[model samples]
Target: MPVRRADAPEPERRDLDVRGTSVRMLSGGAGPDLVFLHGAGGAGRWLEFQARLAERFHVRCPSHPGHGGSPAAEWIEHISDLAFHYLDLLDTLRLERVHLVGASFGGWIAAEVAVMASHRLASLTLIDPVGIKVDGWIYPFLFGMDIPEIVQTVFHNPMAALALAPPDQSVDTLAFQYRQGAAIARVSWNPYLYDPLLRRRLARITTPTLLCWGAHDRLAPVEPCAQAWVKEVPGARLRVFADSGHVPHVEEPAAVAAAIAEFCGGIR
Candidate 1:
């Protein structure tokens, strides 16, 4: 399991209905609003990294509908559905603007939100995100791999990957994993794993964006697919973590946090 610092307290969890979708949110600290979005298949559990981030920012880590404790929304048709729902969430919370930080599928949603409502965003940080469809780029099917295989193939550090999996894979846990995978597929299946037209829409995003990628990412390699985001988004900057993979925040939290802190400093 990922080791928690001795100084870190357990996070507080709660639920709220955002636009008819029940959202489970893990909250901590108090400062500027920082919204953390996890990848597909993961839950707010990964928000442990956000606790450290909360030291300087009020962190709100919401379980995307259909993942973890959050109930699946019937109306969730596409990635854009998630983007709009989060907008509703901000409105419900009465936050004028927030620093958006997302990973994997959450990163894709952040990009969509920046394009659709950049004015409501203070800044954006994406870590090994996937959403745009690029020819010849094959996104590893995370749902298809067993936990061990996933850990070996998707994560650069085996220890981090092992920490991410449940201690014991009971029948109940396996069943829940399948159910979560199915729900994720429902919203992200048609074009295999990405929106076919999302790449063309990147230019409209006006938020100061930071794209961070793990150099060893096999799921979404940095060279072509992941690095493409830096070129597409106007004024977007890229940072590559040489020793990390898809989930850099978990693999190298300190480095990820430092990069984010620097990027967010300009906003405030």
Candidate 2:
């Protein structure tokens, strides 16, 4: 529901065959290759954040398997499977020295991917990622909450979320949401969103990393989660948005996009 500017270029939708599994991708702009991995909710939607990035980078947003228009992959069992899948995706696309960005659950996947192959990425950006756990910090059970409550929990300001609200929750919309939730459950339900081994593996990531966080995040509180990531990932820097919550890109798209551009620009 983001207001599209007249000058914003329309993204091209294409289907990719990543190891025989068809993946849907929205790609546009004409600069360095930058791939964005969406959160549990934002898959397949080109938001204002991505549009802004498209102005500066050739943004490639692909829907994770089992989400969006992509069919579920039987081979995907754990979150690690997704990490390997994306590695294959990069090879399939013949992309090298890519700028990789991910948010929320997708952030977790990005971290796993970077751990396995940081050399493939030029820079890694994680926005409010939830791969590692800090003692005494607990993530809220998102599946237990209704859509409205989930919306409120994610956005610091109600009006910020309202500005991009969908017109209505039609049957198809609700079904799509349900399917996406189920896809999340498949990989994340066992340990309740955090991978026990991922924390130990983060040190393996040698890529230049940027950690973006919403200061007011209630889902994955910033004080511990953001700090934990910055501490574990070597040389990973933190950028906190004061007026946002869990989903800073959705709540403060322009600011988040600008920060990403600045960070990626400095990656050399």
Candidate topping TM-score: 2
The sequence of per-residue lDDT tens digits that candidate 2 reaches over residues 86-164 is 9999999999779999999889999999999999999999999887767789788888897689888888876667654
In model 1, which range of ten residues has the least summed lDDT?
40-49
lDDT of 1 at 56: 77
Query: Model 2 lDDT vs. the true structure?
Result: 0.86
On the 0 to 100 scale, the lDDT of residue 245 in model 1 is: 82
Alpha-carbon RMSD of each model: 1.7, 1.6
lDDT of 1 by residue, 200-230 (tens): 8999989999998999988888878766887
Per-model TM against the reference:
0.94, 0.95
